[model samples]
Target: MSVNNKTVWLTGASSGIGLALARQLANQGARLILTSRREQQLEELRQSLPNSEQHQVLALDLNQPEKAKETASAALKNTPVDILINNAGVSQRSPAMETDLTVYRTLMEVDYFSVVALNQVVLADMVKRRNGHIVTVSSVAGKVGTKLRSGYSGAKFAVIGYMDCLRAEMAEHNVRCTTVLPGFVHTQIAHNALTGDGSLRGKEDQDNASGISPEQCAADIIRAIESNKAEVISGKGMSKVAPLLQRFFPGLLRKMLANR
Candidate 1:
């Protein structure tokens, strides 16, 4: 579906891919309900748009899955969510064994549970209307596991599966579900990812540092949404060959990673 003049609710809108998408959507005449934990950043982004005053920003933490329904309800009060972009997520930098339980749980809450919760809350309305689009932002890691990203990959895979199932179920209802699997977009996700504890990882992966920009990622995502594509893989490293190598040529992939 075309994005123009649609009421779209985008989470993680304070920065990175979400922020870039908000800008692009605003320019294209869409009304957006921007959400994130940083109200200041949201406000700044709100002003960056064309008719800056027209956009809306709601500050809410996605870690609290229970709050998703309430947040959706509030957003729908002004404008019903015709399009829901589940772009809010976090990552991890350590292996499952080394990462604290709290860290993993937090990642699960944001990357998986909250997205599911929000989708559940908004879906009934969309189904009743028999029209809507839901875009879920997954990672390339969702398709293939990697070292130091065990928890992150697990959560991404779970969300991807959930979205896939939801898409299958919603096919008859005119609601489209598209899962965007990006390899590495030059976003601040690494900066916000959890370390061993609750602290931010505060470091960008070398590959991510050299990855695609959030603007480019947003553009590709918009194209996918327009075409109602079920799945999309962005970035060079997200190729089908990457997963193939992970399965059959694990040793070679490991050596390549070691060299990186």
Candidate 2:
């Protein structure tokens, strides 16, 4: 689908990939509804994009998915969202044994449930119109498991399953569901990752430090959406090849992960 003139509702738009995507979509002539908990940052980002005044800002916490679902769905009921990008999420940096149950719950709520909720809000409209795209930002972790990401990977993996099913269902409706599995992008995700105790890690991972730029990731994602690709992977490190390896060399991949 052409991004030009499309009304894209983007979450997590205050920073990182979402921020970069907002800029690119605006430059491509799309109107946007930028969402994030940081109202000030969202407004600032909206203004910096092209056709700034034409965009909308609706700051809401995805952590509170119920409220977000209600508010966002309400906003779109009359707005006709041509695209919905489920990019709002949190991350984790702890193993299953060490991570608190609450931490896992938080990850599931923010990373999995919230994406479903927001997508549900937009699905009806898209199905009715029979012309819309839903791009969800999962992670390369979704395709493979590793250390320090049990909860995060679990949620991401769930997203893959959910979006895969959605893609199949939406195909007949002429609605596209493209799941993007990005690896470690150079974003604050690592620094903001939840630890074992459900507290922020507040430190950057070496993987993220060396990962692809958010702008680059966003561009790739935009291309995937435009092409209606079912799935696309981005970023650096083993993320690029882990899925292939897992499929062809499961035991080797497991052994390699164990050593990491």
Candidate 3:
């Protein structure tokens, strides 16, 4: 789908990939509705965008399942979303056996359920109008199991499954769904990820600090949307090899990851 002048809603727009995409789409002439938990950052992002009134900032907590439809409705008050970028997500890093149930709940709410809820809200309208694109920002973890990323992988895998099903359901309706699996992007996700204590991790992971930039990730996402791709994977090393390794040598991959 062409992004020119399209109305798009991007969640988690305060920073990282969402912020990068907001800037790119805004420059491409798309009307944007940006949402995140940080109003101040969202305001700052709004200032950097091209369109003033055409773009809006709504601070929202994706942890609240009921808030998904409400937030979408609020955004619709400003303009219809021709594209929904379900980018807001939380990550968790701990031994799955040691991970707290609370962290699991929070991860599921923010990373999986919230996206599903918001999609349901906008789907009816899109189906009726027969023109819409849903771009879900998942991760390479969605396709391969990795150590210290059980919850994160679970949520992203759920997104891939749901979007795959949604694609089949919407095939005859003229709606498009694209799931993007980025390997690792230079974003605040690692710092923002929930720790064992239900607090954000204070330190950045080695991989996150040395990963691809969000601008590069966003460019790939935009290209995938333009092509209406069902799925697109980004990054070099682990990004390219993980899927192949998972498919052909699952036991070896598991052992390799454990050693890492």
What local distance difference test score does each model get? 0.86, 0.90, 0.87
Estimate, for each residue in 1-260, the C-alpha lDDT of model 1 and write its tens digit.
89998888899888899989998999898888888888898898888888777678878788898886687677666466889999988888876677888888888999999898888878988999999999999988898777788888989999989998999999999999999988778888888778776688888877788888899899999999999999998777544367668788888987876664
| Sliding window of 10 residues with minimal summed lDDT for model 1 | 235-244
Indicate the worst ten consecutive residues by lDDT in candidate 3. Answer: 71-80
Cα RMSD, each candidate: 2.2, 1.0, 1.3
TM-score of 3: 0.96
Q: For residues 90-136, what per-residue lDDT tens digits would candidate 2 score against the true structure?
A: 88888778888889898998899989889888889889988899999
Tell me the spans in candidate 2 whose CA falls farther than 4 Å from its real position: none
- Pairs in clash, predicted candidate 1: none
Q: What pairs collide in candidate 2?
A: none
**Which candidate should be chosen as best, given TM-score against the real structure?**
2
Candidate 1 TM-score versus the reference:
0.92
Best to worst by lDDT, what's the order?
Answer: 2, 3, 1
Candidate 1 Cα RMSD (Å)? 2.2
lDDT of 1: 0.86
TM-score of each: 0.92, 0.98, 0.96
